[model samples]
Target: MLQRASNANQYFTHWVTAAPESRELLALCLRKLRGLNKVRIIDASFVWTEPHSKRIKVRVTVQQEAFEGAIIQQSFEVEYVVASQQCPDCAKSYTANVWRASVQVRQKVPHKRTFLYLEQLMLKHSAHKETINIKEVKDGLDFFFAQRNHAEKFVDFLSSVTPVRVKKSQALISMDIHTSTKSYKFTYSCELVPICKDDLVCLPIKLAKQIGSIFPLALCHRIGTSINLLDPNTLQTADLPSNTYWRAPFASLANATELVEFVVLDIEPLGEQSGRFFLAEATVARASDMGVNDNTYFCRTHLGAVLHPGDSVMGYHLTGTNFNDPQFQELENSSTYSSRIPDVLLVKKFYARKKKPKRNWRLKRMAKDEGELLPKKADQDRMDADYEMFLRDVEEDVEMRNTLALYKAENKKEADAMSMTETDLDDDDEVPKISMDELLEDFEDLQVGE
Candidate 1:
């Protein structure tokens, strides 16, 4: 209890630790002095120096009418002690490799082009933001998350954009006997379809019949949520959905690595046209066999609109070539599909280039953590080749370039100022380049030093 001063009426002061506000402090004082007689709190006000100040002054007014029907007032002050603390869940985030769930994405193919494309898609959609860490493995990438739901969300994103089959499993991490609580670490093993764009996939007989009766030897022209295939002989196109692909999956017989160059001897376009593809018959001879032999191959191609008589083209030579795939062997043995198979399936027309053209624009790459184990010399070379192929595809395919962010190269002015020889000028004219309008200025480099 507090009483009036002997010399004069004085205001009383009190200190409180971590008291919230004036109203709460007044309530606390009222509760403490509830047992006292004829004492009532009228109002209270608080003033703080800063928004998050640790100390505050609270003025609380009290009224006492016990002395000869006269009223007396008093004030009080409180100081709060602020401290920081972390909960168990938040503390786990600061620790290394403390993920509760992980998604291991894998592809059985021998190249990394598909993974590079998937990385761009994930970055464009901002799907990788939820992941705690992304580590690159030999075949694919592994995404880690602090929660199972985050991993599931990432898996859903992968399934939506690409053809992948997911196998989920959970491991027991910890258990509490008193609370009957169990902690689990979940793992999602996701395997992407081995097929990629521009690859020659030998579809299963039954699967081919189901997808619009297209040819078994079809070229994967485009791959999105579904695999888009084109039959060069008939110019017929079909789509193989992700679900259908996983149920009866088949591998690609030949990819860009197996492409054999051929010079177009003659080309005549037919009246039939499907979008950008024009049906035409072409007489092509192997580039290696041009001067040695007069042998030439007569085949149907869909690139008639773009190909010229003297142009070089890349295609897969099927005649006299033996493949170990069961699907290809079955097609070869079957009387129904054996005769319909073409000797050559032209993939893309090639442009003459003595050297790589100087580009004024560049693409941004995702910062991914490749594992600590250094790759072997052969594996490293293969990876480099695959990345170069991906870069070329990005440059040639306008649709692909649209999905990625292109920035103006920092050395664009220097590249533009450099003089090119006659040969370099000719190469620059032949090679595809991105326009300046399509590239965005990168302002991240504009930050001035503090």
Candidate 2:
């Protein structure tokens, strides 16, 4: 069954350890019918008199056989015994190190935001469905697969979505006694790129000249297999591939910190009147500490059109080492560079945090009686009436038709199964018990009749 490529012909026996449905039983019995004089089964089905019972009565009828003769009719009954045990998937889940291959993903960033975002993408694309387990780690996520190909497939999916650097390694676990070929366990290490959106980077002079963007600085607009950089001054853009960024990684990361409220003293628009970029003279100080640095300082921003002379706006300051300095410079450039960096090279705009309406946050929860929590008696009565109406509708429950068939076969009387079931259900009467001996005698009688 495992080797078969098509599920249409697969058959599950009683050893399958789960309740086989009517379709599974029919498929099993059809295989049995094929062996009897090469019989072609016309119809095969199963029935369970007692719901939730493992015992199934399979009825089969054949319309054609290998031998030609007068029309022959036959009805046969087959019984299946199902036992309870752990399934293969459940066993793999319970066992440790059962996976053949695992993909380990990591990021150098401090936060788990990129990993969490990848998790959502994986779920949307169903990239990890074949994985035995998906675990979240402090740095990233781990995906374990029953087959090596499934792990590789998920890794490909991860690479398609994000910039991932991969390396593979294997460890010998055991050796074969006959061929002496060692069996090795495999693992793939996929590390996501460290930089992310809206980060400030101190660009290297060599890369700066190649990309033709803002010199010595750029802001990250997007992060993928390629990095998209935008010149904060000129609004120009440069997209560098992963290999290029790695080979010349002089872009020192500048973390985006908390918002700083800068009071506007003077504002002037740059270029055309319709342009978004603006030149502003503003003071630098924390929102909490409004005392120091009240004097105006030169600052450039794209949001100057919205600000008035007194309105307060927030911004993020870039902080990083100077890449052109002799201490960090690997390449020689004749042009002079600043030994000491600016106090704050640039301040990127952030959303002005709005103050929310005040309300009591810690209201005490109350305890109530169980009777109050339970459904009201009126609701219970309505539910009972609705159920009764549903029982009267035989079309809603096809199994109820079997009760009619049994009544007609035993009593030879025309009766409505829905009405009979409804009357019995409404009575709330206890079922009369029958002994094993009586059941055995009834079975014998049924056999004799057949």
Tens-digit lDDT string for candidate 2 (33-133):
43665665676777655744545577878765335675666778877544444434334444676877889898876444455445435644667679777
Per-candidate count of clashing residue pairs (backbone under 3 Å): 0, 0
Question: How high is the CA lDDT of each candidate model?
Answer: 0.76, 0.51
Model 1 residue 327 distance off true place after TM-score fit, in angstroms: 1.8
Best by TM-score: 1
lDDT at residue 146 of model 1 (Cα atoms): 87
Model 2 regions more than 4 Å off: 1-97, 179-182, 248-251, 264-266, 271-289, 304-349, 352-450
Number of clashing residue pairs, candidate 2: 0
lDDT of 1 by residue, 109-177 (tens): 878888888877886788889788888877788888989998999999988888889999987654444
**Candidate 1 has what TM-score?**
0.74
